[model samples]
Structure formats: C-alpha cells, structure tokens
Target: MSLHGLEEYLPSLVQFCLSVLRISLPLSLAAIAGFWSERSGTPQVGLEGFLLLGALAGATLVKLTDSMPMGFALTLMIGAAGGMLFYWLACRIAINAILVGLIFNLLIAGIAPFITKLIFGSTGSTPTLDPALRWQFFPYLWAAGILIVSLILFHRTGFGLLVKFAGLKPEVISSAGFSLSTVQMCSLILCGVISTSGGFILSTYLASCYSPMMSAGRGFMALAALIFARWDLPRTFAMAIAFGFFEAAQIYLQSVNSPLPSQFYQALPYLMTLVVLGLRRQGLSEMA
Candidate 1:
C-alpha cells in the first residue's frame, strides 16, 4: 500500500492494539501467577478464587477509602494473606494441594456474598466505582513493568534457578540444605500478589463493580496459557496476549454486521481456545 493508505490504517491498528492490551492485562497477570505457583511444584487451580477475592477487595476498599493507591495496597495485603492461608492449608497441613485449591475456590465462591453484605449491606456485588477514579491505561503499564521485572528475575537471579528446581527436582533442593517449603511459600506469595492485580484491574477498570463470579473463567484461561507455554514465563505471557487478541477479535466481530448469530461471536474466543488446545494435544501425541 502507499504511504497514505498506510496512514489510513494506522489509527485502526493502534486501536486494535490497545484493545488487545486492555483485554490481556488480567489474563497475563494471572498466567504469571500460574507460572510462579506451578514452577514451584504447587498446583494453582484456585487462581479464580484469587481473582474474585481481589476484585471484591479492590472495589470495596476503593469505595470505602476513595483512594486508589490505598485500595491497591490493601488488596495486595489481602492477596499475601491469602497466599499464606493457602500455604498453611495445602503445605503445612499436608493436604493435597489440588484438593486445597478446589476447596479454596468453593469456599471463596460461597463466602464472597456474605463478605459483600457485611461491607456494603449488599450481597454478591459491590458498588459501582466513579469513572473518573477508574484507570484507563495505567494498569497496562503496571502489567508490562511486572512482566519485565519477572523476566529479569527469572533469567538473571539465583532465586529463579531455585524456583525452577523446586518443581523439577525437589530432592535437589532438599539435599542442598535449602528449605523447600520456604521457597514454595515465597513463590506462592508472589503468585497471589501478581494475580490479585489482575482482579483489581477487572473490577476497577474493566468493569465498574465487583459482581458475583466476575472472574468469568479468565483465571482458568490464564492457567491454560501457562500450560500451553510449558511453564515458560515468556511463552506464557505471549500465549496470554494471543488469547487476548482472540477475545478482542471476538468483540470486534460482534460489533460488525455478520450473518452468524451474536452468540457465535460471543463464543469465538472460547472456541478458538478449544481448537488451539486440541491442536497442541494432537501434536504432542504425534511427537510421542
């Protein structure tokens, strides 16, 4: 195309890129969380719970205190506390970690309404946030910063090596006289912190309020991205962005006139997910 034609396409391209980034923010963070948890040999099926709780806490605190920074600070604290609790239940108590994750998901789903009731005299949702108070692009910057820092840490630090070994060779860590539990706990805490930030964005930026089940399976999608990347951090993040692009396409398709029903457009992202996973599984089987 000529220069003028290219210029005509530039604005649409920019808008599409922004949409993908916005949709991917939460998924990318959650995928990073899964990377941390699973890299340390801890199964993190309860990421949905983390997202839900973070959304609720973020919306609640911001509504009560009217300070975004304070809301975020308190939300991270809550996430850390949640990490500790998960560690105690799944690690210290000697319960199966997967079972613990499942229980955590159910427990949070059941209790969120009561907590909302106590805080806002309502159940299953929080009050709407002010549009002026809501963020536009700052959270994307935060997510990108986190991705960069995590990449640096994973590639350039001993902690990253230790975490990698914690999953691949727990016996090595134990034989080396390092505390495996401590390593796992630290990873989990970071998992919690990062994943909750996704929820914060979901509640405050993506949506106006925290509603019941607001996570909408993005947590599981994030997990899928992690697995699809074979637990590689950079690959996991890239997969998340890919999924985000599919979602953005879905929304864009919905807006344009098409012969297909709206429901098909709504399910486009999920359908793409199944197709991608199926292809991956088939390729793995053939390799085997």
Candidate 2:
C-alpha cells in the first residue's frame, strides 16, 4: 500500500506493457488467423510454417530488392501461397494437417540455412537487410488495425455468421448450398497471410531473413492463445496481451536482478499455460 514503492514500479510496468503490446500484436493476429480457419471447419495447424515462410520471403525479397514495402507485399503473397499448399496437401490429399505443418516447419528451417549457405557460401546465418528496410512500429499499427477489423468481421458481419455455422455444422452448411471447401480454402489462405505477418515482424523488425527456426514457439503460443480465448477474437487479444506481459516480465525480472533463477522466469509462461488448460478442462467437466 506504499505509494512510493508503487511509483517506483510504474516505469517498469509501463515498459512491460509496451513490450507486451508489441509481442501481443503478432500473437493476436495469428490467433485470429487460426480462429477464421477453425471457424470454417478446417483446422489450421500450419500457422508456424506459414510464419517462417513469410519471414523468409519478406527478408530475402527485401534484401534483394532493397525495398521494405516490396518485401511486405511479397511476404503476404508468398504466405498465402504457402497456406494454399498446406490446404491442398491436408484437405485435398487427405494428409494430416498437423503433420503437413510440421513438415513445412522443418522444410523452412532447413531451407533457410541451405539457401544462406548457397547464396552466401558460408555457414553463418543469413545477413541482415539495410537499416532502411527494417519494419518497425508501422507493422504493429497495421496489426492493431487488423485486429479491430477482424473482431468486427467475426462478430458483426454476415460472413462471420456463416463461418460460425460452418464450424458448428459443416454438413448443414453444405446442405444449405454453401461450398465448405471454398470457405475452408479462403480461411486457410487468410490464416497464412496473418501468421506470416508475424514472421515479417520478426525478420524485418527483430532481425533479418530467417535464422534457423527463428519463429521459436510463437506459432504454438498463438495456438494456445486461440484455445485460451475459445476462438473469440476480443478474448484472444486479451489473452495474447496477458501472455506477452509474462514474457516482458521475465525480461524485466532479469534486468532488475531478481533473486529467482533465470530459468524460473523463463518457465513462467509455460507454467501459466498448464494452469489455464487445467482450469479450462475442469470448467468443461463441470458444465458437462
């Protein structure tokens, strides 16, 4: 209850919030991407793959073309294409979507290194782009705008209702003369585009080109947020921000020389995930 102590933490809290906001923007968008695909009755487990591909495409293109805008544009297009490919393999070819996504992740992880070696003729990671080509706050602004638009589209629009109907009863939607496959295909493409933006942010803003597995666990984190939010866009955003806050807190804790082990701080988010999932399962059982 001491005002002085509380004031002392205000700056740290604000910095934490800003870091959370940056992290949340990509996560919320990726969750929304998953939301659309799942709401259309197609499970999208390949968001990570799409993200890696997009990041690679954006960074590579920007480096080659020396235009950040061009890189952004290329990233969107390539991401959508990659998504379409996954849909073809999973939905059309009867391959498991999760497996397909995992394959894509491996492929990108390996391909980036191979390409770096081929192009640069060295074992080091891909080189960074010019400073002028880096993406920054603009992508975050765009992500926030997209989140707002996605919320409205998912909740307020006719398309939203159809998507929900498709999710709940795909056969019924099909019986109503709607093409389920088409809806799913569109959803997959959109998911790819959105998830890829996360990659773009990482590559251009955080680093350049894809370093091996640069996506880390963000794709899975986004999936966790989707489940945590129960596919609701607004709730997804809130959960993403909450997760982001923990991530930022870990950094701040390290900076402030917390007595707790660094590994404990690193493990905090995963611990929270386990707790949240357990609670969700319990809630469902009670409802049942």
Candidate 3:
C-alpha cells in the first residue's frame, strides 16, 4: 500500500484495482447468474451447488487432460445438465424451487467429498495447481463479456421481455404464446453456467486447487448482494465489486499478521455486506 517506494513497485491504486478484480469477478458472475434466473421469475437457491460443481469439474478435468479449454467445456456441459435436471424436477413435480435448490446444495456437499476422495484417495481436496497452469485473466474477460451480454439481453430483445413477463406474470407470458418452460430452461441454464464459473475462478486463481468447501458461502453472499441491489444489474455489479474489496482486504490483513482477531478478519466481508444491505434497506424505506 506504500506509494513512496521505487518505480519498480506498481502504484497502489493499480494493485488495488487488480486485487478487487480478483476478489469480485467471481461474485459478479454469481450475481448475474442469480439475476438471470430471477429475472425469469424462477427462484434460484441452487447457485451454491452450481458453483461447487463447476469448481470440481474444472479441477478434475484440468488434472486429467491438462487442458484448461477442455476443463471449461466440460464444466459448462455438466452445468447445463444440472440446470436441466433442476428445471425438470421443479417444473414437473411442483416442488418449490427453493427446496430443490437446498437439496442440490446438500447434494454438492455430499458428492464433492466423495469425488475428491475417489480421485485423490483422501478427503478435503485435490493436488495443488501450478501457478502457470492456473487460469489467470480469462475469467475476468469472460465475466465482463457476460455482463455486457446480460445488459443487452435484458434491454434489447423481445425474448428478454418474455423472460421478464414469465417471472412477473406467467399467465401473461403464456397468453403471449411463450412457453414458461422454455424461458425457465434458458435462464436456469445460464444460471448454472454463470454461477459455476464463480467456483471455477475461485479454484483456479484463488486457491490453485479444488476443495470440497472452497466456495465457503460465496454463492449465498452473491444472492444477498443481488437482493440488496434490487436486481439492478449495474448496482449488483457495483455491490459485488465492493464485497470483493473487503475480501481483498481480508486476504491482505491475513498476510500482515495484524493484531486483530483472525476471526474478525475472516468475518469482515460478510459483516460489511450485512451492514451495507441494512443501509440500503433503510434508505429505501426513507425514500418511501
């Protein structure tokens, strides 16, 4: 953070921006994933599941084939499959989407360890990834592309309108001749692929390996961020970046051996998120 050093040292502002990107990119993706699902009127509680599965898939595939592209393709395929499965059960069986999501989250908790054990012959995690082999800037580019695409999709297309209608008024969408299943399916698939990428980013860049519990409730954090932003994409994106900054601060604090309780450093991001959300809610009430 000191700017008085040699020209060799990058400016503090530049370093801060990079750290923020590293921390927030995943959250941005997760928020957008939630946005896509809810924008279509479908409740998404499965983001955590989607994210963990993606991380597992990425780590396993990269380990097997030593190809990041292969890992990404395979992760997307698996995400798509999971999304469709959830859609079928939620749509056909009349189960609440939130319940289905909770089941999937539990499913991830069960299956990630099982797979990790089978592959590594132990529990907790796989082998640590080499820095050169880990994904670096690609996920950032992908996140930006996704945000742009989402903004255009929501504002520029009739299909986007249908997606909105489906969520707010299924009868109206149906009357307009749009199949509710189709809209939900598309959104869920997007949600799966996008949300899972959050895990992918965390594993490949943040940790260098996939662990069963690596995400550590970030998916839920993203959900909370979305709620706080009232589903507005720009605000959601900003809030996610803010959360990322706190996470970055946590990481920095950990390294400095700060006198603060380690527990407080760990809780910093979540605490900040709660405080900001409360403030946002209070401001909204005052405006009313």
Using lDDT as the measure, the top candidate is 1
- Which is better, 1 or 2, measured by TM-score? 1
* lDDT tens digits by residue: candidate 2, 1-288: 699999999997787677888766666667777777776766666667767776777777787778988878888888888778877887789687668878887787778767778876655366777786565579778787878777788789877777878777778767888887777787788888888877888778766556767776777777777776677788877877887776777777787888888777556556766777777645552111
Arranged by lDDT with the best first, the candidates are: 1, 3, 2
Clashing pairs in 3: 41-167
Q: For model 1, what is the C-alpha lDDT against the true structure?
A: 0.85
Per-candidate local distance difference test? 0.85, 0.74, 0.80
- All models, RMSD in angstroms: 3.1, 3.1, 3.6
Per-residue alpha-carbon lDDT of candidate 3 for residues 108-160, written as tens digits (9 for 90 to 100): 98998898899888796878766778665788899999999999998799878
CA shift of 253, model 2, Å:
1.1
By TM-score, rank the candidates, best first: 1, 2, 3
Clashes of each: 0, 0, 1
Using TM-score as the measure, the top candidate is 1
What is the TM-score of each predicted model, taking all chains together?
0.90, 0.88, 0.87
- TM for candidate 2 is 0.88
Give the runs in model 3 whose Cα sits over 4 Å from its true position.
1-10, 254-288
* Candidate 3 Cα lDDT to native: 0.80
